[model samples]
Target: MWKQLILLAFILANCSATEVKKCSDDKPFPLAVRVLNCEIPPCDVIKGTDMIFEIDFFVMKYVTKLTTLVRATSFGMTIPYELPEDVRDVCTNLMYHAYCPLYATEDVTYLFKFPIGNYPEVSVKVEIYLVDQDKDVATCFVCNIKVKKGPTGNTTVYEIDY
Candidate 1:
């Protein structure tokens, strides 16, 4: 039994985060997020391609006041996605208070059609932030993903769903 335990420990230590997505614990805002699209963490994405993300989360607060901001980082570069300026004013209150906050404060599903830049085959970490109008981060989320390399042989048009 002891030997078995030792073997298990060694295996766990050798495991890489590439096979698992590492997300930071919720702070300031406590929330739990579920990736609705992939089976594992560090979702597999093809380099120099576009990927889609679907997520469901619940926030521990009243939806009366908050701002949502999304940012993606890879190869030490950060990309920020914000509410479109043209419709920001109209959508401000709509998203923040879309649901009746009598019970759950933040509960929604988001869809992101993100482009995977020319970053090499590496691990990409994405951060989602919910902040107040004052620029204070209300809640933060981190998701680890992998960027796969392009195929070396002939590629099919149907296989271009990177």
Candidate 2:
């Protein structure tokens, strides 16, 4: 019985999602943000690995297209990370058969795979945004992450709530 209780507790703890802050007061917040292998702030991102993020959100109006934007800030300088052309289009990455022409009150899940390159080991503030067809912010969130050097090959799967 004790073992079963401990297992249940561990499962529940692992299932908890990450808590994230909005990028701006005017920007809309996502329903939830989950970063694999990063359950808390200062998520450790190893160089030459892929960092995966899942965003759950809802649209307030019809949207024919969506784009993803990412920026990292450190030491008072902000650098925009340009996503590949294939990954920049958010509509193509929606989960569960959801597609654009997203309508009001529609729940959507977006999956983003970010490749960590050869960047200096440091802590950074990351801002992720999803913009609609009209250039309106659909979902925005900010997370603090630490980039570290490590042996990199395949993507590592972990849970992080932001």
Say which candidate scores most in TM-score: 2
User: Per-residue lDDT of 1-162 in model 2, one digit per residue for the tens?
Assistant: 999999999887765667777787779899988887778888999876778888899999999999999999999999998889778899998888999999898999998887788889999899999998889999999989899998557956454533
lDDT of each: 0.54, 0.86
The true-versus-predicted C-alpha distance at residue 155 of model 2, in Å, is 12
Candidate 2 whole-model C-alpha lDDT, 0 to 1: 0.86
- What RMSD does each model have against the real structure? 9.5, 3.7
Indicate which candidate wins on lDDT. Answer: 2
TM-scores, each model vs. reference: 0.49, 0.85
Name the TM-score of candidate 1.
0.49
Candidate 1 deviant stretches above 4 angstroms: 1-37, 59-106, 152-162
- Candidate 2 matches the true fold with a TM-score of 0.85
